[model samples]
Target: MKKTIVLVTLFIMPIVVYLFFASGITNFGKLAMLTHDVSEIDFADSNVALADKITVLGFLGSDVSNKKGNAFNLNQKIYKRFGQFKDFQFVMVMPKGTEQSVDDLKAQLGQLSDVSKWNFVFGEEDQIKGLFNSLGTNLSLDANLGTPYVFIIDKERILRGRDDDEDEGVKYGFDTSSVADLNNKMEDDIKIILAEYRMALKKNTAQREK
Candidate 1:
């Protein structure tokens, strides 16, 4: 009986768990793509390597100092957990002349976690607007080329976000100012996307092996 139970638990339970998620009608396990081909902007003074990377993209306004609390929340909730992933990165675009402020912000972020993958790209206001426009999102940049929202960009530069959001109908970006939103929604979505890639990689490897 002991050996039989172990066999059923190891084999049958795996199939049961897989089928449960596979049959989910909402397909909530997978993150939805909101925009396609978010062109990587080359005009930045400091450009992040966007090709073939999973990026958490944001725009920090001219007054980076004011965003300290939001930045800390992101670092603690998102970056700290996912920073170790090979292709995962945080790309924050800032209008030109925010370099010193960004550097200071980085210093503070580094105290919390390894901020190596935290990339800050500097660009003119026009350049920043151009990049943000390519996202094809309903959101708009503030006067200083910043918003309280940030987004998830897949390897192909496509925007991944919630489409059937109960509150917003079509959720485009994660709000930085809301810790509860980040903890409850954004973190889970991040996990899904990362797992999605890992599963794809595993499938590709298995195919190659076969």
Candidate 2:
């Protein structure tokens, strides 16, 4: 009986640990959704060595029309805070027609603050659909789901988290009403992620000095 109990405990221990850390499991589906390599994106042209840059990729829905101000505000905050780290870049990808033109979006972003360090990429409806679908983000442009969904991608091209649980590969409908809250939540989450990156950089720098 003692030996049998020990075997059972050993078998269940890993399951318990995995459940505890399940949320940190990397989203492989989201990682595959990236259509263009961050290093090759046009905005990265001048900075080809983005491997050293901490990159954030945000995806907004088609319904985010006329909400340019909100988007700009969030991006501005992230840019200002993350810019403190060298080689850090933030890229906002949105579907076309939901907001204004790429230039208009850039202008709005610029208005928030001097956002010259960031890049804005505009995707047509179909292209955006493809991008999201590849990442398992289940909202469709035809369904009238507005923008506001966001995803964070690291320099290694791993998607940290998605706004909707369904987008994270779980079974469920996308939450339309949660976009605004997600916008707010993401702003805070990005800061934490940047801090983690900074710490990792510091550790590497210390190791080199030694």
Candidate 3:
């Protein structure tokens, strides 16, 4: 009995240590702020004011493929979920040559474009790439084709990541067809940040009154 107990304890000890470190590694921290002091990134329609509101920034390519449309479609789904709120905005940045597709893409909204809330911006390849790098977002884009990641930039221009997702800051491909994982995770994260912001505002107001 004594020998058996000793062997079991040794086996369980390593497992316990492994689980502890794994949880710590996956536990998300507060949203990360910009690595540099450039302030805000400029879009074609508006120079997205960081301190103004929460921004959901997504990227689309000009390639004749589904990746670009997948990212846009995901954005559409996100808008349907939170379009009525004026405090948030979704901006989609695409390659410059595809600007003509704006009309067709707008039809996907099933409503008129709310330029203030839903903006479709474009720029030269270099310009777009520069914006991504400036914000400390890892983007995989080229002259006409690339797979980019979606990022949540808070009011203070901080890049928000998940509290339990290890890859929250890692750039990955967007595929709306499989909406359960990526799309839902992002929507939930947005809600979490919005709630945190509201709570902070309330606290500030109370302090001011006191």
Candidate 4:
């Protein structure tokens, strides 16, 4: 009786494990690009460009202090993980006059992690609107010209996100205020996009070797 029970337990365990993982597979092999050729020309007073890098883009608006919590949440949850990866960057688009506000935010975030990849770019109101409009997302900037949401942009200057997100169907951005969104959905999408690029790089290298 003991041996039979042991055999049955072993037989059922693998099936249970497989089903658990199968149920959790939400993302497709690659995250679909929702917006193409997002403008990169509006960034000012900075050397950062969105052309050939994976960027987590955000807008802090004029009242930087109000968004401090959002920034901390993002830095702790997302930036700390992928910030230092090659060609990965965090770009916060701020209005031109608020450079000091950006500096203060940077100083605080610096205590938490090495924020060398955190690039703050200044832009005029019109320029900022032009850039934001190019994203084609349903999201809008707030009264101070900021939103609590941030988006993932790929190397080709395209916005990458889920087309069949269970809640929104077309998830254009992740809310920094929600840890669950960052952990469960955003992180998985990030991993998928990174893997896609890495695979392409490997294939190119193999072709070169041949």
Task: Give one digit per residue, the lDDT tens place, for model 4 in 116-143.
Answer: 9999998888888899999999999988
What ranges in model 2 sit over 4 Å off?
1-52, 60-65, 94-100, 123-126, 138-146, 162-184
Residue lDDT tens for model 3, 133-205: 6565444555563444566777766676643345544533233455665455655555566656766787999
Against the true structure, whose lDDT is highest? 4
**Residue runs of model 4 more than 4 Å from their true location after superposition:** 1-27
Q: Provide the overall lDDT of each model, using Cα atoms, as 2-decimal numbers.
A: 0.85, 0.51, 0.60, 0.87
RMSD (CA, Å), each prediction: 5.1, 12.8, 12.8, 7.2
Model 1, 1-210: lDDT tens digits are: 999999999999999746533543234667788889887869766547677999999998998988888899999998987799889999998888988999999999998888999999888887888889988989998777889899999998889988998788888899999998898778877777777787799899999999
**Residue 160, candidate 3: C-alpha displacement in angstroms:** 1.2
lDDT: the better of candidates 1 and 3? 1
Residue pair clashes in candidate 3: 28-163
lDDT winner, 2 or 4: 4
Candidate 4 TM-score over all chains jointly: 0.86
What ranges in model 1 sit over 4 Å off?
A: 1-27
